[model samples]
Target chain A: MLEITDIVTSYGKIEALKGVSLSVAPGKITCLLGPNGAGKTTTMMTVAGLLKPRRGNIAFEERNITGRDPGHIVQSGIALVPENRLVFPDMTVHDNLRTGAYSRSDDEIEDDIARMFERFPRLHERQEQHAGTLSGGEQQMLAVARALMARPKLLLMDEPSLGLAPLIVEEIFRIIRDLNAEGTSIFLVEQNVHQALKVAHYFYLLEQGRVTFGGSPGDLEEDEVIQRAYLGSAEQT
Target chain B: MEFVDYLQAVTDGVMQGAYYALIGIGFTLIFGVMNKINLAYAAAAFGGAYASLGVAALIGTGDDFGLPPLIMFLVSAIAAGLFAWIVYTICFRFTPDHYELATLMATVGAFFLIEEIAVHSTAGEPMDFPEVLQGIVDDPMIEFSDAFAIRGDLLTIFLLALIAMGLLLMLLYRTKLGLATRAVAQQRTAAQLCGISVDRTNATTFIIAGVLGGLAGAMIGAAVGVLSPLLFVPLTVKGLIVTVIGGLGSIPGAIVAGLLVGGLENVFLALRGITERDMYVMLLLFLFLAFRPQGLFGKKAVRD
Candidate 1:
């Protein structure tokens, strides 16, 4: 489980995350839905230790991970699939995945890599190919698979479906569901509320760097303003 | 008749290029990993070579009661690597990452700092380096038509440079540390997201490059038969020239470009005077910049 309380993050003169808070329960997909510039990615980055917060705390399964080094945060079993699926372009797919397990010193790394190949067959097919050459959908899959190589207790996926085709979006949602079912907790930041609601057990709507609503899909559907803002159809939701 | 002389000059030029390649590879690695050129690199090279000279001077390189001839190279390499790490931490570590110019300017200052230290320490005088290829540079090792023979010392430098290049290539492609370094080079943020410490990788990269630089300095000292603070600025300029011609971050490009520049410089020196020689070299650099901005091996506008 992950818990964030009243965190504020900034870049130079501008504060991106201002007094924000959220929680992700264990073994569940917790989706954070927000519009552009709503501090969704910033929240994930702050929790992942990429961005330092000016105030507040982040607890990952009772350990206060706030202000920890990114490498230490990763070692503590949290892996982030960053926005744009920033896979190392010049690196081979296999090398990219290997880098994903950089913090692990266990003997099972090769085994895990083999397991990853099996889990993501497309990755296996192009394991030796450079990741930059991959299609956007393939790169997204590779990014997710790369993060899974870390064997994290919590997976932080930032905009996994952005710029992906519709069919690929479905595949991404399916993968998220499968990952959650396999007991890996996912804290996903997404703009696609409809597809997100289908896989997520709980969803939090973030607006202007603050959580406006937290509820189940059924509850979210009944909220008129939330449906209009995200789903774009108060009549259907 | 004159063609034979030109050919000999080019051959000799290629030998000189070997030294440039050694130092240029180090510069290329630093540029690749850190994305910031360390202007102090050649200074580090000079510093390392001088430190080795100090050791060699103290212990002597003779057979009895002295260190082995090759031990100085290793000593210089390790010392240079550590020295470079210290410089990296002090000069560039905490600088804002986005402002690459700031780091570049800081390194410019570091270059002066390192050069001044060398100058003050040695009283700005050229010191003779212990000859690596003993009793051979004046004599031809492999004679060809009397005019195109490979000088023993130059041949040795070329062979040593080739070996260094081979080892560097192996370390980069066939090792885990190299993997992390390449990852960091390609995408720093993505590398971090994967739990790879970009800072540590960048540091390791600098150390590796510094080791290479030290070897280059030692080789240059051995070849030129002298060590002087005056060699510092010129070597740094040559390195920058090599780095640019070889493509900004491309190692293979750097090596090839180094040899090209070396060959061209010698040809020009033989045909035109020394003044005209450098002008030709500068012109070649300009051509690469104006026409082929990507340089010899830069095939793509890859990095953002």
Candidate 2:
């Protein structure tokens, strides 16, 4: 449902993405694994239209959305849960979700918000509380729930498990899997390779702004070099 | 020497406070949304008064295309708002957002530009504004000590300001637009990620401030019976002083500080003299900056 062709993005003199390219099919959880400063977040931002690329194109469901404004891109069916879970700290949980559907003119915004609350009961409990007051896990949940309020065709999450406890990380992964199972295509960027490989239908390894490996998780699991680079100190099993 | 005199002074203090609150609220609102102070606000307020005077003159005369006094005031407000938007777009918006010094200098330039325009338009002469609340309540009998009294216009300005403040409070606390504005103010990048248009939000914020400033300007003109460019520069300084003493971005701080400044200034004028009155006010501002730089309601700065 999403296609990126050799997009190059940069900041001042430093180029973050040097002609990186990738794709995600419909209703699948595609994971991009990368180390620190591997331009993973840059790639996600470019796709979300936050940063304009200097070269190549980005297409969503056969429509070219390369240079559209971020607001227009989001309205056209792509929602990004930005890195670091940058929820509007001063706004209440409900307001943050309402802000997510800012472009929608539909009458069921309150219903959608209620549905999100039902999906995450923790969010309902803290609906009136300031988002910044939430715990890290709850804030991550709020960020993901906020993205879902946009009702996008694809959800792009950047390092949703960063700085979370192991149990909370597992819960986040489970939510990702459940959302994918419900036919919402997800492009997740993570450094947690073992857990990502277990859930990702297909995985790509990005290093130095290049996609070095792309295949099914089983194929990557079988490769010794890929396994060592990804697993690091942990056992590949 | 009498209870009536004390009551009259208090009544006058409240009226002056209303004017200060109106101007201070504009200053605070602009600073809250943009994080940049518009030093040109006082000048804009004076500019609105001039517009009101000109429009009212045209209406009172046999001009076929003139608007009524109320409609003229609203049009004057819109004109002032448009003028403010133009000034912001031209002066501040193009400059780097982080170079706050540059933004400050731009607003200073705008201040002088507005002052010069007012002077040139009126040929440095003060023009009288038509009484907005004439005959409605110009002479209300007061039962206070049989001597001291208050004008109907003073009461009207004070009551109207309170009403305006109530409306503003409702807008900020209850409206969706205000919620979006607050989000943008808190975090621009996060607000943009939520698909809130930053430019539109900022523009709306400026227009709102401009309208408030305009109303304050008209009331001041009515109270003083004349509008002049000379008043622009002093009002600008006083507004800035109020904003700083109240707190940078705190709405309630602005209201409380505005009244405090207004009451103190009048009390000093009553006891001492007008010449040394501003010295005490300036000293208070210095103390606020030197000690509690956060003023009343400002948040503690988070170190980066």
Candidate 3:
């Protein structure tokens, strides 16, 4: 479980996250929904320890992890699949997977890599090819598989579906659900409201660096603002 | 008849190019990881050379050059690595990652600082450097033909440079630290997310480049048989040119460009004499900058 309290993160004079608070329950897929510039990616980055928060604290499993280095955060069992699938372009897909496990010294890393290849068979087929040469969908899959290489207790993914095809989006949602069912908690940031609603048990709506609403997906269906802003009509909402 | 002369020039140029490649690779390694140019690199390298020469003086080999070439090289390389560590701490470590210009300017400052120290100490006088094969044999030149031959010292330095490059390639491609380094170089934030320490990797990178730079300095000093403050600026300029022509972040590119530049420099020297030789080299750099700025093997995106 992860709990964030009044975290304020900034870029020079401008603040991206202003007193934002949220919680991700254990063994569940919790989704964060927000418009562009709503500080969604900023929050994920902050929790991943890439950006040090200006205020407040983040606790994972009741231990304060605020302002820790990203390496320490990963060692504490949290891994992030950053937005835009930042796979190493010049490195081969296999090398990309190898880097994902950089923090661990366990001997089972090869076994875990094998597991990743099995789950994402296309990655296995293209193991020696440069990641930059992969398609958008394949790259996204590689990103998720790479993150899974860390064997984290919690997986933080920022917009894994952005720019993906509809079928690929469906596949991504399926992977998220599958990952959660397999006992890896997921904290996902998504722009695809419908697909996210179908899979996310709990969701938070962030607006302008603040959390506006938090509830079950059923409760989300009744919110007029969210329906209008994210979903086109009440029926689809 | 002219072909034999050009061939001889190329052979000598390759021997010289080995040192150039070492220097260029030093620049390329640091640039690949940090994406920030450390102008102090060459100064640190030559600083290592001067330190070894100082050691030679202390050991009473100041006049006769009785010290073995191997020990001199090792001492110079280690000292250079230390100098680089100082540069990294002062210029890069505390500087905020986003403020790249700060690091660049700081390195430029470090460069002048080291060069000034060397100048003040040596009083702008050139010191003699030990030759690798001077005392080993009576005839120090290996001849393939009447027109083609390599000095025993140059040949030894060339072989040593090749060995160093081979070891470097092995370290990069075969080791876990190298994997971390390459990962960090490719995607800093992503590497961080994967729990790679960017600071540690950067520091390690600086030291590695420093050692390699030191080796390059020793090799150049050995080849030219002198340690002069005047050689620092020109060699540093050549190193940068090698980095650009090889491709900013490409090691293989650096190696090829170094040899190409070295060979071409010699060919030009054979045809046009010394003053115009550098002019042609500068012209080659200008052509590269104009037409293939990404360099022979660098990805175009590196220009971004």
lDDT for position B140 in model 3: 92
Q: What clash pairs does model 1 have?
A: none
Each candidate's number of clashing pairs is 0, 0, 0
* Fnat of candidates, each listed: 0.78, 0.56, 0.89
Q: lDDT tens string, model 1, B1-304? A: 3888989999989988987887788888988888788998989988998898888778865533144435667777888898789778877789888898888988889899989998998899897776665642455377878777777777777887888889888988888788888988898887887777888888888889888888888878877888999999888988889889999889998899889888989999998978888788888888889998988887567744
lDDT of 3 by residue, B202-287 (tens): 99998988888889898988989899889888889999999999999789998999899999999999999998998999999999
Ten consecutive residues with minimal summed lDDT in candidate 1 chain A?
A228-237
Whose DockQ is greatest here?
3
Could you give candidate 1's per-residue lDDT for residues A1-237 as a string of tens digits?
899999988888788887898899999999988767878999998988899999999999999999887888988999999999989898899988888888888888889889989988999999999999999999999999888888999999999999999999999999999989999999998877778878888888777677777887788553553454454433323
Per-residue lDDT of candidate 2, residues A1-237 (tens digit): 899999999997788999988999999999988666778999999988889999989999999999788888889889999898888787799888988888788989999999999989999999999998999999999999988988998999999999999999999999999999898999999877778888899888787777877888888543542454454324212
DockQ of each: 0.77, 0.59, 0.85
Any residue pairs clashing in model 2, and if so which?
A: none
Return the candidate ranking by lDDT, descending: 3, 1, 2
Q: Model 3 over residues A148-184: C-alpha lDDT tens digits?
A: 9989999999999989999999888889998999999
> Chain B TM-score for each model?
0.93, 0.91, 0.97
Please name the candidate that would achieve the greatest lDDT relative to the true structure.
3
lDDT of each: 0.85, 0.81, 0.89
iRMSD computed for candidate 2: 1.3
> Which ranges of candidate 1 are over 4 A from the true structure?
A222-237, B61-69, B135-140
RMSD of 1: 2.9
